[model samples]
Target: MAAPSAGDRGPRVTGAARGGTGRPALARCVAVDPTTFAAAYWGRAPLLSRAAQLGAPDGFTDLFSPADADELLSRRGLRTPFLRVAKEGRVLPETRYAGGGGAGAEITDQVLDERVLGLYADGATLVLQGLHRVWPALIDFARALGATLGQPLQVNAYLTPAGNQGFATHYDTHDVFVLQVDGGKHWRIHEPVLPDPLERQGWGGRAEEVSAVAQGPPALDVLLAPGDALYLPRGWLHSAQAQSESSLHLTVGIRALTRYALVEALLELAADDRRLRATLPFGLDVADADRIGPELTDTVAALRAWLAAATPAAVAARLRERAWAASRPAPIRPLAQAALIAALDRDTRLVVRAGLPWQLVPDGERVALRVFDRTVTFPGACAPALRALLTGAVSRVGDLPGLEDDRDRIVLARRLLREAVAVPADDLSGS
Candidate 1:
């Protein structure tokens, strides 16, 4: 696929020469030329591109309409350091940040609450859950980026107005790709004095923030117009502010797995055993330390050997599986009682969750359903009956699978549907 030019128009996907499948077409639109991006920002400074984000759905504002923004604000899901205030910083109440460590105070839950503010950074917040639903095009973009980077990708949406400070001048652990969706913003990037810094996840770390020197007079003082993007490597200290009436952007964080995380996960797995779960010999007498030395060394050596033998494919597979398992689908309220029943009774389509694998097989008279590692078969005569339940046909639990018979099937279907593993579709007619 050819690189998108500045004057390119239409859906970002349209710019790419047509390919055989939608996947390939989407791939061309989203694939970041890593070699080009890496040369520009990897371990050096920030790189900005005007219209880099033109392909991004409607440049932020167009992507999230007023109503859509309202819905996101009302969602009480995962919270993070999502909001910014002009001078006050985060708008969430002080109580929300009182618990946990000092880090908890850094994020404001008000962003997740959808409370609107003027002058203050007020806009819809889109985390993984929100993105999973209303943003298929973005998801496709993310998937393509992941494929190009050979790593997992996470895209976060931030909307703010002029003078809003999304974050302080600090470094993140993962590399970031910031795409301006609407309006404009001023960005300042500085060189990192401390190279490849790591965060302390446990207690007992110096509370002082590491200071860094300015690289080259804010390096690039550029205004991000709609459809523009910037790439910054991890450990690159930077800050941003809306330069226009309002600014919206999607920051895609590229995750890099470290040996430390791998070891930590393996240790947690090993802790399930009583022997490994025992307290460490720290603070113990010198005599006890000597006795534990051999065991500790042996364990460490074994872990090292195991990790050394691990293949990149296996690690990627495990990461993908974990990501899919953790993903939560958007909540869809059931239709009204009468409408649901009628719709289900009629032939309808049913679909499995996105990014999940499933298989269907012909059963004696019905069909066998398998999803999210679970499987079940319905009798051929009950195909229509099963369809009703699968398609959200019934209003309440007693609708199709009636409270009396087929209780097991009803329970199983309910569980799958609730988890978003199964969805109803229109019959023959793709909806």
Candidate 2:
């Protein structure tokens, strides 16, 4: 790839990206109306939103720089799958480019920069996977977009050397939004050989079909420049080549929940049925299609009956669990939070973690504060103060409502600080 240019990049997305009135993360990616996108393009067709049409002058350089990629490759200790190298559609093995960690570190398979440089010089595409977990700017951007789209999102970056095509024409299992950060890339997109493919269905199974389709004229042929964004649904056949220079782009993959997943949840619920749990006919011919026909018919009838009786309310809880598991909360520094909790007082300032989702549910005599997978219950008397904290902004312990005394407010604040649900405000003005 190319070197990081020396100059001011642009305004980058930060923690503040979560609650903005302007175009949201999704709006920034797609230059079209949100309603139009939902009705016409989402999961249905390919849409290219040129950077010029995106309204904001800022490009994605602020999100990641070539310097950042070099730092990850040369400084951070990255392993095999996290940092993969590809040349002419084939992934180079770790043995060819990775080495063992030295001295104090006991692990092997750390990427060697010298090895990577040699591979890149010979025309290899560098794939930086799961960057949202490591890169700060991307972490915030993914969270903001995921919250808006009601689906989990992961980010990866592709940095290809000049004039090289990373992979041959193929499709992804999940939908993607390709945000071009630096330089240029020529993209050729074709209709899907298989539509709306699930995670288990990969393009490798249909290699011949993909190659034949790639030989045909493209449905859309365009050059993605810096600040350009392209949205491609799952199973859309596509390929890209770096232009005259290297191209650095971020691929935001959407992990959308599907009807099949809901059906899985329903089947899990059906396990509770005593009828479904009953054993099959004693000593039955398990492989005889003729003998199994009646049983299959009966099973389908029973399933339909159970499904008719099921309600959305029953399945929603499981869906929430799955969604929360897919999404990530901001990392909290344990020692710092511990210190803050110990020193906390009624005069201390607090800020709610951005994008933290929580709710108060009645739990008998207590109220349950449910955030992510955990539940923190407090006495019903603490309701008003808890309600005050959900404003998603800075607050002072002394200003919290319902707690009659400063000591009680301090106690509640201390618990929350320990929970990391609330953090100490860095600035008094909440700026």
Candidate 3:
């Protein structure tokens, strides 16, 4: 679909039922059709929208107050990893950099000690465990975008201040939908100049480094305000910078399984076959080597032909699996007994991890507790007692139904409390 032009207004969107109030609360000013865009430029750059994007709720900040953000940053061992501008194509270790604060400062110097800027642990980075609690609005946005793209979606968020460039200009491995949540930022999108642009499988190196040699002048340059969004297909070289203030944005990265990935996965599935597992050129003799060449080529050709024929079906199945799999929640690891007790005493507010399915239903004696994503369902007879736990109320196991002498329920509930899936009742109010 063509991007909404500066003078043209895009489609209007109303808030979904879950958005509450039943009124048209959140709306988008521009909405480009993804199918048309994908057909024309699946791996190219395209600006999606620049209007009404800011109408999405900002309630995510309320979930994590400045104090909660600080506690999370400190407790999770989160660090800012610096990307060497020269090696922008390479992934850096997570611990290599430190937070630089709101005002710009040298990596070696620690001037402002505030938690406002630099590399902070985004909820995704630290707890991959409780994203739903950290950014509920982004989760909803992902579902909306997924419906638009006709595929599953994953959303990640990051915050940076003026002069803090997260990474150097480069291409993403996957297509991306960038939403400017708060403040404004600048983007530089360069046209694809390399032959077979966006086809980096045979580039013999990372796309970022390979494209650097063929870098062209940016085709589009724009400053995105709070409600603006941009879509850049895979292999499009781009860079972003916050405009003299702090910025927060969510990047919805779409994972596309290409032919290369399918073949790789097939190879993995074929690992038990001696022919598939054997290294090529199996003999040292010159005659044997010459004879093996044709056979080896034939084997590769067969594999390629098979993959080429099966790719569409395979990719569709994989996408469906990924969509369902993405909804499952990460298992919460148990904390030390002492720490768990302390956390409970402090009346911490627990939050469900993002994407996990849950429903409230009436059971026989009380209410049945069924956690859909996890496939764990228990009788409603435990409702009266489990309801409090589900509601993050501070109640002991003894207060639960059918658990007077059972210790397993107590242990399980304690584990949940430690994971912040359940917390004391008082802490629930603010969050």
Candidate 4:
């Protein structure tokens, strides 16, 4: 299935965290059980699972194939950042692989197939970023895997001609799973120069250290064949070179939650303390450590008091805001949803959007439906029907709970359909 154009989807972000199912996606990558992987190698170590050792006989081909890459590069009218080319260790400028699309397109950076072809022949590596945002299968797989791991995730694919390497020995600030989709790639992995690096600490800061680490004996040295997978935590030094044939692999990067994030949440909660916001003494020598010592001591005491009084619930709310805002729910076809609203009737079938995180909250006399970025409120009488439709399975408009009249049910269903909270069940067949 193809992706919806950004114009067709509007302001809604199509990438959501929930995979809408069980742990099958995680199974496809980690050879060990989920519990075992979490305890042993999740962030502290690396795990490698060969093609024969992983789940699903089809491996990763179903998620993304070579043909799929071609379709995106040539037919998807892709823009930069979403797709890029690298030779040696440098990313080629957009002009190298993209140019103006002919009349009516207006876009100047639409990918040019001939340009990509020339670069591939010259040993440039194709890096396709954000496959989860544009590719249907990857969208589902990433969402599922993120749900299982309780982390924000993204997917990128690398395609290199034989004997070429796209990037130098380095480490990412986030964890990664390398899923081999086609051919072979010889890999050399070494221990981390800096363990558990935060987002702000990039490999560039310690390029010298990383280069040094790569010179040491590898902790693991192996060729990843089709269907094989490798898991690496952040700060691990590594590099790969394509074998005889071309190499294609998907990198599923995980933004694992950290203690620092929790500290951020707690500090945000500290904003409520008036002492923390108070000014220092007037005419105080701010730059002098001797003069500032007493002030810092008092400030520490005040902060300690605030921390002692803080509640887990308060910090949790801030974390929820940060995490929820970073992700998006499934996209709705606006035009199709509009059509469904116009034709909504008792017999019309409807289902809540898959993996949508929403709830009905009491808002005075009205009840508010909290989903995505906005709160949609309805009169208190609609609560029963909202609960039935949102919390229940795929159902008929007439089947909504507590709304005695079929007209009331249809009206509620139509309003919800307009809100993009639910879609016509038949729309699920496509992406």
How does model 1 fare in lDDT?
0.49
Off by over 4 Å in 3: 1-30, 33-44, 53-134, 147-152, 193-215, 268-289, 297-431
Query: Can you tell me which runs of candidate 1 are displaced by over 4 Å?
Result: 1-47, 52-58, 65-160, 163-166, 193-210, 215-219, 254-259, 272-295, 301-321, 329-333, 336-349, 357-420, 424-431
lDDT of 4 by residue, 285-388 (tens): 99999999999999899899988877765665566667656555566788888887888889988877764666566677888777756778998898877877
Q: Give the CA lDDT, 0 to 100, for residue 23 in model 1.
A: 32
| Residue 196, candidate 3: C-alpha displacement in angstroms | 9.3
Worst 10 residues of 3 by lDDT: 1-10
Cα lDDT tens digits for candidate 1, 301-322 = 7666655555554443344344
Model 4: residues with Cα > 4 Å off, grouped in runs: 1-23, 429-431
Better model by TM-score, 1 or 4?
4
Candidate 4 minimal-lDDT segment of 10 residues: 1-10
Q: Mind giving the per-residue lDDT tens digits that candidate 3 earns over 285-365?
A: 546767768877877876665555444434433333444455434333334333654444222334443333344455344
Error (Å) of candidate 2 at residue 319 is 0.8
- Better candidate number, 1 or 2, judged by lDDT: 2
Candidate 3 contains a number of clashing pairs equal to: 7
